[model samples]
Target chain A: MSDIVFTNVARNFRRDGKEFPALRDINLSVRDKEFLAIVGPSGCGKTTCLRMAAGLEFPTSGTVAVGGVRVTRPGPDRAVVFQQFALFPWKTVAENIGFGLVANGVAAAERARRVADVLKLMNLAGYESAFPHQLSGGMQQRVAIARAYVLDPQVLLMDEPFGALDAQTRVVMQEELVRLARVNPRTVLFITHAVEEAVYLADRVVVMSRRPGTIREIIDVASVRAADSWDRFEKIEDVMDQASFVHLRTHIWRLLREQQAPDDH
Target chain B: MSRRTVVGIATLLAVAGLWYLLTAATGWVGSARFPNPAEFGTAVKQIVTGGYAGARIHEHVLQSCKLVAMGFLVAVSVGLPLGLLMGWNRRAEALINPVFLIIRPIPPLAWIPLAIVWLGLGDGAKIMVIFFAAFVPSVINTHAGIRNIEPFLIEAARMLGVRGPRFVFGVLLPAAAPLIFTGLRLSLQASWTTLVAAELVGALLGLGYVLNAAAQDIFPAMILTGMVFVALSGAASTWLLGRLEQRVTRWRTA
Candidate 1:
């Protein structure tokens, strides 16, 4: 069975007595351990798609199943990293990472161990006591990532997780996400507006059409795993400069650009 | 000290100098209604050392503080949870809000006659009035605080498998805290404003009681003394509230 599946999903939201459809006739499947990115314009239900699988949103008419079981509500099996980082302002970095584990009734020692592991892995070793506001935007997003990663859920759902960061930070976060997937492979249903972001991190990029969004195309990119080295950042940055990376990015950009223009008479 | 502190002290001195000049020096304003600065100073010394209305000045101040603390605490204990419920659950809001709206617009001082009839001329009536004053603002602001929580925060919490009470206390409350504290501060101010008004009905020991008696006797010095006490206490409470708010919401600062 696929890690996640959306079978004929449609979502409708009502506003002022009008039933506005956000997504329609959506059918997709994410293979186990696959990193799938959905790239689309704003208001195109890319987020709606990710939220449906996360069980934060329910499809109006279709089934969202994970591991062959239908999703009825949010469960520990799937974890989400939101765009705003949404780290609890009152909580220190360690507390935010340990939140889910504590809720799950993990023993204190084990929770601390897991939290320490994620913080170290995310390169946030000594800053565990700092609050979210005390950290930079990039560091805050790293805490958010560690928050999700510590859960070790079956699937990670990211909704424009780095969209708020500056360009340089966004690139670094993307590389961090790639390294995370390499070390501990899991299904990731990633959504982004940046074509390069989608192409860089995804195993297969799912191009979504405009409103009442459905899958337009799914392009498979060559996978580049993190090399076992201290200089992982340089190796990943070099992946972006490859000819295939440029070619694929241009192709996705053209597809998105073409969809934005009005159809010819 | 800070520049702001220097400016504040300067402003106070300037205002006092103007009042002294007008009433004591120029005699442009009569000292009957507005006591001269020297007489006011003597009254303060007399009240602090000698006594006012057969009770020490501190006794009256302490009594008023007790009334406000009791009423404000009761209002918060009841209103905080009630408001949180109203904000969280639609049915609770529908059931409770209409009556709250109708009664809220009627000022707490307006409740004096009815409170006297119901609870009699005692501490009960005074506290009831202060409670009403504090309760309305507390409930309204707490409800608003909960309602104003960012939708993204709720979404993020739910996505992390947080729900029910954990979500309410853990996610909702902290997110709504800045506004909740704002509600508390407003409620506290309301409690103080209505304290003297509450003490008007047959009370004989509070600052309000002393001031009322002094007003009948046309003792401007006593009135000014009472005003000074009220001003000082109000400033103290506000400063305390500010410190509390700052400490609780330190996370808001970068």
Candidate 2:
């Protein structure tokens, strides 16, 4: 069964007495265990699409399905990792990770075990009792990832998960997420504005047009791999050289610029 | 000793020295109104031994504390849940907000006559006055605390399978606790002030009653003693609440 399917989805928002369309006629299917990234300009509704899939927002029209079931609301089956590292300030690192388990009424012992496992995986084993404020930005994001992972969701929805991090930390988190996806092959719908992040993590990158967002192109990066001696930067440059990747980026850049241009005529 | 203790002692000595100089100077204006430190000390000893009033100093202190405690308990029991409801539901806000706005403007002491009419001149009337004084701040602050939570945090929690009462208890309450504690502290102080005002009417006990009696006899030292007791009780209660706040917000400090 397909992990997630969005059929001609549309979303509109009413602001200041005007209705603005965000996403329109979007159709996509993410296969089971596939890592898909949606990349677009600032106002292109890439985050909106991920939010819909995570059940934080309902589509204005059309349907979104996960694991062959129509997603009516958020559930344990699709855990979301937000961009801002939304760890509960009052909860310790361990407690935050175990929040979903606790809410689902899992036994205390089982919850503790799962939290411990994920903490170790996220390299946050020794920081279980620390609060979010006490942790560094990168560490807090690790906690966010651990929280999502501990849920063992069939699909992971990430919205610019490392966008707030410094360059070095962002690259580190990207590699960690890659290693994580390798070990636990869950379908992921990742959203980012960064082209390098899209190329590095996604099995396929779905490029979106500017506001009233529509899919411009989808570039499959499954076969683009680094040679044995090539470093990560070289691998990224190679991926950027692919004609499909270059075309998609330039095409998206033009579309965004047009969206920003004044309507003089 | 700690710096706070050292500074406190130094301040006390300075005040005592000033009092002695003022009383020693006969031509000094309003010298009789402010007694010397020695006279104040003697008066405190007499009050402790039931020299100034029929009742000992401890009796008044205990009475005031009992009233404050009862009033604070009532305020918390009513205010916390109401605040949570208002914060959680927009409908509750629409319905209850007008009533709160109407009631909040009326001073706590204004309720004294109604409380007396309803409950008679007793502890019941005193506590009711105090409760009215404390309730408004507690509810308003608690509602603000809940409303001010980051929207993204709530969205994140919802997307993690949290909903209904579980969501409120697990995420919302913990997040809003520091702000709520602030409200509680303010309410407690307000309750103490209300208790004193209530006692001024017809109370036979409490620091307020003692202060009134001392004022009638023009005994500045006894009046000062009463004032000191009131200040001490307020400070102690506030310090206790501060400790509680620290415990609840320890996670943020981590």
Candidate 3:
């Protein structure tokens, strides 16, 4: 069964007394424990799709349902990892990770236990007291992911979570993410502009067309990465070297490049 | 001492040495208008050991501090919450901002007459004047502080089930604290300035009272000493607040 279902979703934002469509007729469903990546150019509403699922924004014309209930607003059952990390500056890594549990009124002792578990899972144990600014970009993103994981949400929504990191850091983070998914599997809807990242991480990649974005194609990552033995390519370079990886990357690039920009003239 | 501290002390001494050379050593300006370093020392000693304007040096400092504290505490307690609500809610801003704008631009000293009429020339009148001086900036800075908090942080808080009172305390306040402290510092400095003005208009004891009395008596040494006290107190309070800011916001990067 699907964990998240979007039914004919359309969103329009009113600006200067005019309704501008952000997403239109978008229908998608994320299966339980599936890793789905949505890729498109900027302004294609890929992030909007993730935000809708997170219940941060509601579609103007359609419904977004999580675990069979219609989403009205954000809830603890679903968590988001923002592009900027969104870790509270005043809070240490551990406090930021435990913020949700504290807000949910988890007892302090239980909060500490769960926070400790996630810290060890994300390899953030010793850095608990370090503030976000004290950490490197990669480490901060790990804290962000750990924060989401600490809540044990049924679905995770990430909006370019690694978009801010340097390329070298991005590669390491990408490998860590897949490692994280293997240990703590959940329904994930990841949004990104990097086609290679989509091909690298996602079970299936959803390509979106420009402006008032709609899904153009859904490409299943090929046999090499899709096989049960895909774990054999544990290293990112090894995964990149696979012939199927290059083919899927080229395919998504062409699909994205072929889409025309919406004509306003 | 650290190099930075050593350099800072050296700079202060050099400035004082230059002042001594200009006034006491060369006697370029007469002691009538400009008191020499030796005279300044004597005036301070006299004030400390004896008294100034019928009140000792410590009494003048204490009185001025009390007036500032009264006005400052009230302004912050009222202004910060009011400004936060004003910035957070569109309706609150629309309703109260116009009256605030009208009151804010009028100089605090300009309220001396109105305060005298309403509250009389007691401590009440002086505090009222200082209140206006501190209140305007307190409100403005608090408003800006709340408004300047990143929108993403608020969204993150909401997603974590932090809303209403919890949202304000857990997220908004801490996130806005660095800026709020800045507002507090500015409000405090403003209060100190208006303290002098308030005492100059009416009061029996304060550094400002001492300065006015010394000016009228044409004792330049006494005036200079009073000026030094005021400058030193202002610097000291600001430094104290800076230290407090550092202690509270250890998470913030310099």
Candidate 3 global lDDT: 0.89
Clashing pairs in 2: none
Consecutive 10-residue window with the lowest summed lDDT within model 3 chain B:
B245-254
lDDT of 2 by residue, B29-116 (tens): 3636876667788889998885455588889888899999999989988998899889989999999999999999999999999999
Using lDDT as the measure, name the better of candidate 1 and candidate 3.
3
Candidate 1 lDDT tens digits, B91-117: 999999999999899999999999999
Predicted structure 1: clash tally = 0
Off by over 4 Å in 3: A222-224, A260-265
Worst 10-residue lDDT window for candidate 3 chain A reads A221-230
- Candidate 1 residue B142 Cα shift, in angstroms, is 1.1
lDDT by residue for model 2 (A53-142), tens:
888889999999999898888877788989998889988899889988888888999999999999999999899998889899999999
Please tell me how candidate 1 rates in CAPRI terms. Answer: medium
Q: In model 3, how large is the Cα lDDT of residue A47? A: 93
Distance from true location, Cα of A6 in model 2, Å: 1.2
TM-score of chain B of 2: 0.92
Task: Write the residue-wise lDDT of candidate 3 on A1-265 in tens digits.
Answer: 4388999999998889999998888989888999999999789899988888888888998899988988889877888999999999889999999999989999999999999999998889899999999999999999999999898898999999999999999999999899999987889999999988998889889999988788999988735575635678778888777777888889898898877565622
